[model samples]
Target: MNLRRLKYFVKVVDIGSMTQAADVLHIAQPALSQQLATLEGEVRQQLLVRTKRGVTPTEAGKVLYGHAQLILRQCDQARVDMDAAGRGLSGAVAVGLAPGTAAAGLALPLLRTVRARHPGVLLYLNETYGSTLSELVMNGRMDLAVLYGGRVAVHGLQFLPLLKEQLFVVGPASLPAPPEHVPLRLLGEMDLYLARPYNVVRKMVDEAFAGIGLAPRVVAEIESASTLTAVIADGLGATILPESMARTVVGACKAWQCRIIEPVIEAPLALCQSDHLPLTEPAQAIKEILLELVAALPGSLIAGDDTRLSVS
Candidate 1:
C-alpha cells in the first residue's frame, strides 16, 4: 500500500484512538475512517478492534504492524542513503541524554568522539527527562537516547543494556558524614527532594521504600537538574541518585555522597532507539563510539552485584 496510508494507520495505532489520531494528522475523522476501510478492503481482513476506551490491533493487524514498521524504517533509510550518495557519511543525528543521570556526563565525550570520527556529520545533543527522550526516539525525532530505565518494557522502542549504576544518598556538605553505608530508613526519616515518578531512579527508590512497607518523605518532585542542585545546595533536603550523577550533583553543590546499604539499588543504563529504525551510517558510527565511551566508565560507579541488568 501507499506510504501515506501506512503512516496514518501507524499513527492511529500509536495513539489508540481514531479521533485523537485524526486530530494529530489534521484530517477529518470520516476521511480517516474511510482510509481505514479502504486499507481493510485491500487486505481483506479487519485490522483493528475498537472499544469504548480505544482501539487495539487484531491478530492480523499485529502481523501487519510489525511489517509496516520495518517497511517504514526501510523507506526512511532509503531516502537518507540517496541524500548521502555524494556527501560521504553526513546527516543530522539527534541524541538525547537523561538530565541528572550519568548520561549527562556523556554529552561532551560523545560530541568529541563524533567530531573526530565524522567531521562532516552534525550531532544534536539534548538533555531532558528519560521518558521524554524515549518518546522522541519512538516518534523518530531523535536517533538515539542514553537513558536510565533499560529495565522498562516500552512499546515501539528497543533498549540495549549498557551498564548498571550504583545508587547513593547525597546531602549538603554541612551535614554530618553518614555511615560508610547509609540505610534506606535513615533517608526515609529525612525530608527529601527527588525526581518525578516517571524517572527510573525515582521508581527504584519508591519500590525500595515500598519493600519496607513505608514511603519516602519526599517534600518535592523536582524534574530539572538545576532545580535539584539549587535545592540541595540550600540544604532543603537530601535525595538518592546514581553514583556518577550523585558525584556530579555533590560536586556542584558542595555535598557528600554515600552508598545506600539496607537494600542496594541500581538503575540500568541503556542505549535507546526505535526498534524498527535502522541508524544512518553517520549515526551508526557515533553510536559505536558512544558504546566505547560507556564501556570505559569508571569501575567504582558501575554496579558490582550484577553482570547485566534487565527488567524483571
Candidate 2:
C-alpha cells in the first residue's frame, strides 16, 4: 500500500526468502513476516507460498509483484523529478560496462564528461561481462550499460549504436608480417590465446572459425584482455581480438594487428537501457555526455574503421 511496504516486498521477492530479506532490509524476521501478513490480509490474497527449496510467489503474488515494481519505480521517479525541478541534475546514476572494447576505450571519457558537466551527479560504474550487464540493466540494478551487439538481446530495452569494431589477428611485431590483411585460413595452424567460453568475443571467434571451416588451436584461456595481449606479445600465441583491443595492445606492448579477411567479423557496441524504467535526470545527463564523447572521436576510430593504430 505504501512505498516502504512496496520496497520491502520487492526486496523479499528478489532475495526469495523472508529470513534473507530481513537481513538485507535490516529488520527482524518476525517484523518482516508480520508486515507481509498484514499486506496479504489487506489485499485478501495469498501472496507467497513456501516450498522446501525456497519461497515462491503465488499467482496473485506474481501480479502484485509486477505492480509493486512499477509503483516503486514511480516513487523513485517522483523524487528524481522533484530534485530535478529544484536543481538541474543532482541524483545518482549507476552505469555498467562490459569487458573487452567498450569498457576501456568508450566509458572513461564519458565518465569524465559527466563529471565535468554535472558535478552534482553521483556516478557509479560496474565492470561486468556482456550478458550479465544486460540482465543487470533489465532488473533495474543498473541505469544503463555499454554492451556487445550480437551477444545480448535486450527485449524491453533501448539500444543506441555507439560503434562497430572489426576482429583482428594479433601477434608479436617481431614475427613475419602476414601479407597485409591476413586471411583466416592462413592462421589455422597458429596457437590461439583465447578468452573463456562465456566471453562474448570468445563465442564470436569460435563462430568465425566455424564459418571459415577451420578449427582454432587454443593454447591459453585468459579472462583479462591485457593478459591476453601480453601473452600474444611474448609470442606465446596469436589471438583474435576487436580492433579496440588491438589498439590497446599496440599502445601497451610490441604487438601488430592484421585485419581478418574472408569473413570480416565486426561487432557493434551499443548503449543499452531498459525501456520499462525511465531514466533519472542524472542518468539522462550522463547518457548525453556519453553520446557527445562518441561523436567527438574521429569517424574512423568511432566507426572501428581504423586499420592499425595505438590506443589513445
Candidate 3:
C-alpha cells in the first residue's frame, strides 16, 4: 500500500469526515476519497463506513489505523533523521513528567532550554500521574519520563536515580500549627487525604507507613492534586506531599500549611526510559539538560541533608 494513501486514510478516520481531512491535508475532497478507496481495494476489505452524520472506521479500518499511525510516525522520524544527517540536532522527542513537582517546576525551564539551544528539535511533553507515564515510556509511546519510586526492572525499563524529595504533612492554616517536623505516627493518626493507590507518591506513602507497621487514617482517596489541595485548604483533612507541591498548592490560596515529616519519608525521583529502544541524539541532549536542571534545583525542593543518587 502507498504510504501517502495510508496517511490519507488515517487522516480521514481521525477527523471522521473526508471533507475535513481534505482541508487539513490540503488535498481535494475527491482525491482524498479516491485514496481511501484505493487503500481499501489494496487491503481487500471495507475500511470505513460513510454516513451523513460522519465516517466511522470498521473493524478492519480500526486495525489499519493503529498500524498506519506507527508507520506515519516512523516516516516522519526518518525524514527528520535524514534532514539532520550532517546538521545540528533536529528531531521530535517526547518526554513524560510525573504530575507533582516534576510537572509543576521542570516543564517550563525544559521547554525554554529546548527552544534556545535546539531550535530545530520538537519536544512533546506529557504531564500525568507516574503510573501512566511509566506505561507510556515502556510501551514506546513516550521517549523518557521523570517519575517517583519504582523498580528498575519493571517492564524492562531503565530507572536512573535522580534525587530524593521529602514528604510533608499539609493542612489548612486554620488548624493549629503542628511541630515543624511531624512524625509518621502522628501523620497516620490524622484524618489524611491522599492520592489513590495507583499514584507513585501514594504508593511510596503507603509503603513508608506499612514499613513501620502502621495503618494510616486516610479519609479520602483523591486523584487530582488541585482537588486534594483545595480540600486540605478548606480544613476537610490534611494531606502529605512533597514541599514543591505544597508550595504550588499554597501559592494559589495562602490557607494551606505544611510541616516536614520527622524521620523524613523521602520519595526517590528517577529518570526512566525503555532500554529496548536506544535514545536518539536529540533525546539524549534533552535528557542531559533535565539531569542538570534536577541537580541544580533549590535546597527547598530538595530534601534537607539528602544526597543525590546516581545510577547508570
Candidate 4:
C-alpha cells in the first residue's frame, strides 16, 4: 500500500470529514476522496462510511487505522534515525507519565537530565491517564511511559516494575485532620472525592474498602487535576491517592495527608515501552536516567521481585 494513501486515510479518519480532512491535508476534497477510494481498493475493504454525523470507520477500517498509525510512526522514526545516523543522537522522544501516579514526579527531572546529557534530543512530556498512555505506546505514537498496574503481561509491550507506591488519605486544611496513620475503615465515614473505578489507584482503593465490607461515601468523582484541586481546596471532601500524588495534591491545595493503615494499600509503578520497537540512542539514554531517578526517589518504595509484566 502507498504510504501517501495511508496518510490520507488516517487524516480522514482522524478528522472524520472528507472536507475537513482535505482542508487539513491542504488538498482538494475530491482529490482526497479519490485517494481514499484508491486506498480502499488496494486494501479491498470498505474502509469508511459516510454518516449523518460525518465519517465513521467500518470494522475493517478500525483495524486498519490501528496498523496504519503504527506503520506511519515506524516510517517516520526510520527517516529520523537515518538522517541522524552520524550526526549524534537527535530526535523527539515522547514520554507519557500518568498524572497522579508515582511517575508524575519524573517530568521535570527527566527533562533536565535529558537536556543536560543529550542537548540534541527533544523530549515531549505528556501527563495523562495510564490507559491513554498505554494506548499511545501500543500504537507507537509514544516511545515510553511511566504508569501504575499492568501486573499481567501485555502483548507487544514490556512493564519494568520500579516501585510499590503506598496510598494516602488527603484533605484540605479546613477539614478536621485525621490521624497520622489512619485505619482503612475510617475512610468509610469520610466524605470522599475520587477518580472513577477505572483508574488504577481507584481500583486499589475500591478493593481495600471492599475488604472492610463498607463503601466510601464519595461526594463526587473527579478526574481532572485542576478540578480535583479546587474541590479539595474548598474542603468539599477528602480523597485517596498514591503517596507520590497525595504529596503533590496536598502541596498544591494546602491540604493535609495521612497514610492509610490497617491494610496498607499499595500500587505498583512500572516503566513501560514497546518490547519490539527498539529505542533510539537518545530514548535509551532517557530511559536509563529515568530508572536512576525513580531508584533515588525519596522514601523509596522499590517494587518487589516482579520485574516484568504486559500492558494488557
TM-score of each: 0.73, 0.79, 0.75, 0.87
195-220 in candidate 1: lDDT tens per residue?
88877889999999999787999898
Best by lDDT: 4
Clashing pairs in 2: none
Better of 1 and 4 by lDDT: 4
Candidate ranking under TM-score, highest first, comes to 4, 2, 3, 1
At residue 42, candidate 1 shows an lDDT of 90
What digit string (tens of lDDT, one per residue) describes model 3 on residues 219-251?
Answer: 889878778877866888788888778777777
From the highest lDDT down, the ranking of the candidates is 4, 1, 3, 2
Which pairs clash in the backbone of model 4?
Answer: 153-310, 154-310, 154-311, 163-303
Model 4 misplaced regions, further than 4 Å: 19-34, 50-55, 299-312
Count: clashes, candidate 3: 0
**Candidate 1 residue pairs that clash:** none
lDDT of 4 by residue, 1-312 (tens): 999999999988898998999999999999988998988898899999998889999999999999998888778878988998888778889999998887877888888888888888889999989988987887788988999966778777888777788899999999888899999998788999999988888888888889989888888888998888888898888998888778888888779999999899888888889888777777787787887788787655444332343554
Of 3 and 4, the candidate ahead on TM-score is 4
Between candidates 1 and 4, name the one with more favorable TM-score: 4
Better of 1 and 3 by lDDT: 1
